[model samples]
Target: MEIQEKKNIYVGVQTTQTRDIRDFFMEIDSYKNILVFAEVGEDKVCDNSLELLGEANRLKNIRNNDSFVIAALVGHNVKKYAPTLFGYGADKVVAFDSPMLEVYRSDLYGEALAGIVRTYHPEIVLVGATALGSELAPTVAAKLRTGLAAHCTALKILDNGQFTQVVPAFGGKVLGDIYIPNHRPQIASIKAGITKKLDYAPKDGVVEDFSCELNGFERMKVTKVEKETETCKSLNEADCIVVGGFGIGSKEEWSKLEELASLLGGANGCTRPVLDAGWVSNEKAMIGTSGVAVRPKAYLGIGVSGAAHHTCGIKDSGLIISINKDENAPIFACSDYKVVADYKKIVPALIEELKARKG
Candidate 1:
């Protein structure tokens, strides 16, 4: 951390065409700095950016030298977030602020991000695998003629300085580790909430302005954008989660999961199958390798068959209670408390027990 502080002192001295940029590229095949794509929405920085910043901070500490964690922030009025990014361990923030960037247009954001990459030439670039990032990362990568690993579940800087990208393969049956040895800036769009956010620490970091014009990119203009407001508690933040799977016989049974969750002072979650079956009304409720990964204090799996993808999401739960009719359900192998019974019978009993205790 002290090393990064010293490096940030002179970061503002790099002119747009200074020999530093050219010299760094000419002398070193790969720069040591890590870059994170900080996406903004509703004039606020998204949590995914902070997650990546946190991971980048850890990676920087592990590298433990002059390595810096820089953030590429693009949006209107997002310069106010520079201090927050610095608190999250960003050594410097390259902000591209324009009225044209108020809303997310893939082409505009991509072009701006690509320009940053061409100028700074970081060793690794991390982006969130959200809707915007899924589209934005590839576009920037294509423009820069680089490869990107999408939906990465894990990232590690190997002993040989190669960035190892880990993602689910063959429909979550196995995990594949990917590395881009030839690319200058190894890019990866990772899933959100996989890593914990770092504690805030004030730092002396510079927020440099990057200019972009949309004169020729008029075709990529965003006419209108409607934002969705969320009222439900986020599954990732829930301390306790009650999840149902395809074994949840019907929609009515799925509703019982909500009631059970309320009784437990928690929230309801579901596997991908349950979401696909229309049992869960919201996709945010789904927990799997493809969806949100949760590590709650206590997780109750009702009628869950425990697919590999689903179990992988909850593997970090403090206490996993799997209640499935099948005694040999795979979830039982990883569960701390296993009950061999139908959820239809167990759900009511749990609610009643909790009610009696309250009485």
Candidate 2:
């Protein structure tokens, strides 16, 4: 028995160059519309999903002329969030209400999104870089045999009709721009907090209900979903951060740093090396590029070397103060205030001063 080749349809991310190539072969004439997947939670859409909708709305204005933004939302109570999406700029919302989508299962959610893409034939697809989004986007792209760019920090529609996607690379030391040079519906996942969500006046956009019947094979069976305990505090969301580096010496010595953080009503963090040394968990590590990017009211760097990777992460902080023995440390360049002394002596003394003040 021999298999036969089916009709070759480009089922993936589309770019300007790809469009031109497709145009030469008359494939561009079959172009459809853009589609954005809204990651629906139980009661609210994730913030990144709203951000994607805002970006989609912006892209639609540039390309559509008369076309509208199509938002595909999957989950129970998806309809309830359609109005908010409209207020945020979705011209049309395709609600796929289902019990299976209530909790994010990769198999079920991916299949649902893939089915919608096949039905609508969107020219582009955008997703957020959330845990669920990361799982669903790649699967959907693979099922549809399309290209995908992940963790995109920037997105723009070029004049020539191509979507340029930018992401951080080289351990966040540099930025890389990617494009699907030849594909159908261009797919990209944007990282959270990269784009601002817009607040637009509510428009009388249409909301359509979409229903699909899945057979035993087509329907995914989810046996169990285990939730992990969120033990680490998100440094990015913290108001104040106390950072310790090699100068702190040992894990036992970190107590002084913690005392200072407690005095200031802040959380204690460490550099990458300190965390790797079993001094602290990665969650409490506040190293530069590879770790969480923080913008706090006050960031105190204790005995930190201030590598480009670490410095970049805390550059957005409101006030940066560094205490290191090396007067020429790189951290001093970016620190708003610097103390040239041994952090072992300085941190303990500072904690005492804070405690005395409170007394």
Candidate 3:
């Protein structure tokens, strides 16, 4: 591999795959580390991305003992997070630092990630299926011309060293498994809370600074960067979550859900219709494919009709209890405990019991 000096590259970047499918084959020993794309900010790394370091470590323990856990950090002033990446099970951190790469564009980020894979030759790649990741994962996979399993609920390793990516299919009625048999680097974008993150135990890991061509689509440039107030911080880490559905009834009734979450020391979420109905305004509060994916320890679903889109997000909860008026609602199929009752009656009784216990 050759390293280029920092030059102002004006030409558009290009992607080149190493070999054709028929010709692409490597000895098992040749494939090395498990690469994670560590999405970063100026001050902190994305929680979802940091969590993948732990996932990589677990996968390495079970599937490939010889592989190192390598994390690729790309952004301006992001070298500070490399130690945190190391503390969270990363054995190596590849830093692609540059001022021109401050604002994230899908094309440039995609190119840098793809370049890192080519240089390091990692056996597997994992990314957090975030707003940026959802857009970025497919781009990197396209550049490398490999298969990508999107929004995986779970992952398993086969006896023959191949890994399976588990995702929802058939309108959330069945789970589909995906794998890349012919590709050198198998890639999957995992949900935020699917796996646990390691404790912040600082370790002295290897760090390397590298650069990719910072040239692309010249017409586009980020002139302004606005940061929204982080209101949904607990949604990712909250152990208890109370979710409402379209069947949750009138806007006035929705306030009870918030009250329940507050009493339980949890967070509240709603389905997409709740947003469209003007019952809720925050788009980040919606949980599903278009919103946040959470795997809380306990999930309470009231008046949920069990749509495929919404069920996909909560299917992995530690304990799932749902109350719906209809006994045959699709949500019943996914819940561990179900009650065929109305939320109005059940919620108030539960709230009263909790309040009584407090008093």
Candidate 4:
């Protein structure tokens, strides 16, 4: 926190950006409403999609032309989720349901989302930065010829109606605030867990069906889909996470991290190298841009060198405690607490203390 304060003092947080209405293209004035891509799974709107709606509702400006929170649902039998959208804060829902969208093809989903944006002319477009959304958001933005801010941690609208997008840059060293001052639709893909879902209410909202022909493709075929079975709670759901890195040295060492997590009633995760080393068989346990981004209440790192790729994901953790032998490891800069010691010493002591307390 002191390092961040120093940075804030030396280098101002570049948060303000503005543009005159005259600077905007003539058609830019046509944009209205905050359109959120409502990603549906298992016949229900995904929580990340609901998170986007709640955030959009919170950021919507009525004075700036009554920016309604409009959710664009595109999937097979997605109309069933219209009420769920309304309950979550959507003022209106536009549904595009078809067999083509049943299976997520980037082209198909992108077309559906792009078509919705073109037709709606939304002032802002929000997408959850999931595996699917990371691909779909860029594809739609390209099709619409608009600027998109990907993997944003924060978003806000200035009094001048400029949309601000905040993302971590330089490998979580500093936060970069981006703005789309002239675009008709300011598009952004929000990283999951940055915000929570709104409370459900029996609010009435309008649902509209949008019909369009999608170009067919046989470039790829999915014969069968299988879901990955996770042995531990998802990183997003766990309040605490015990993460191991390649520095763990051996498969046996990695087991200690898992043991710690299990005892704490939390989840276990690893950096990419730990998985590559064959210490972790569950690929879903990797945390980074290549994996899940977690914001747990407490995150304990064992032998983590804190590469930017890994730190970017853990930077938001509430209480980051890194245990490493290297005094100069990069993670110490960002962690709330640091223990310059070997995991072999810290792990056993921690486990013993917990067991003693239990007894």
The lDDT per prediction is 0.79, 0.73, 0.80, 0.80
lDDT of 1 by residue, 158-190 (tens): 888666777666656566677665555778887
Q: Highest lDDT among the candidates is held by which one? A: 4
Deviation of model 2 at 112, angstroms: 1.1
Residues 169-273 of candidate 4 have per-residue lDDT tens digits of: 665566666766556678889866666678998788889999776876334667898865667688889999999988899997777787789889999999989
How does model 1 fare in lDDT? 0.79
Query: Candidate 2: deviation at residue 309, Å?
Result: 6.9
Candidate achieving higher lDDT, 1 or 3: 3
**Which runs in model 4 stand beyond 4 Å of their true positions?**
1-26, 61-64, 216-219, 250-252, 272-283, 288-290, 293-297, 305-320, 326-337, 355-359
Q: Kindly give the number of clashing pairs for every candidate.
A: 0, 11, 0, 0
| lDDT string, candidate 3, 1-359, tens digits | 01112221111112236455443344435767799999875478988887899999989998756788999998888888888999999999999988867888887888888889888988888999888898888888888767787887667787887677876665555556676666657788876766779988999987899897867633367889898776754676788999999887778988999889988989998888898898977777888755677888999988888776677677678899999999988888889899999788899999999899888
Candidate 2: which stretches are off by over 4 Å?
Answer: 1-34, 61-67, 200-203, 216-221, 226-237, 243-258, 268-295, 300-317, 320-346
Candidate 4 is scored at a TM of 0.83
Residue pairs with colliding backbones in model 1 are none
State TM-scores per candidate: 0.87, 0.73, 0.82, 0.83
Error of 1 at 267 (Å): 1.0
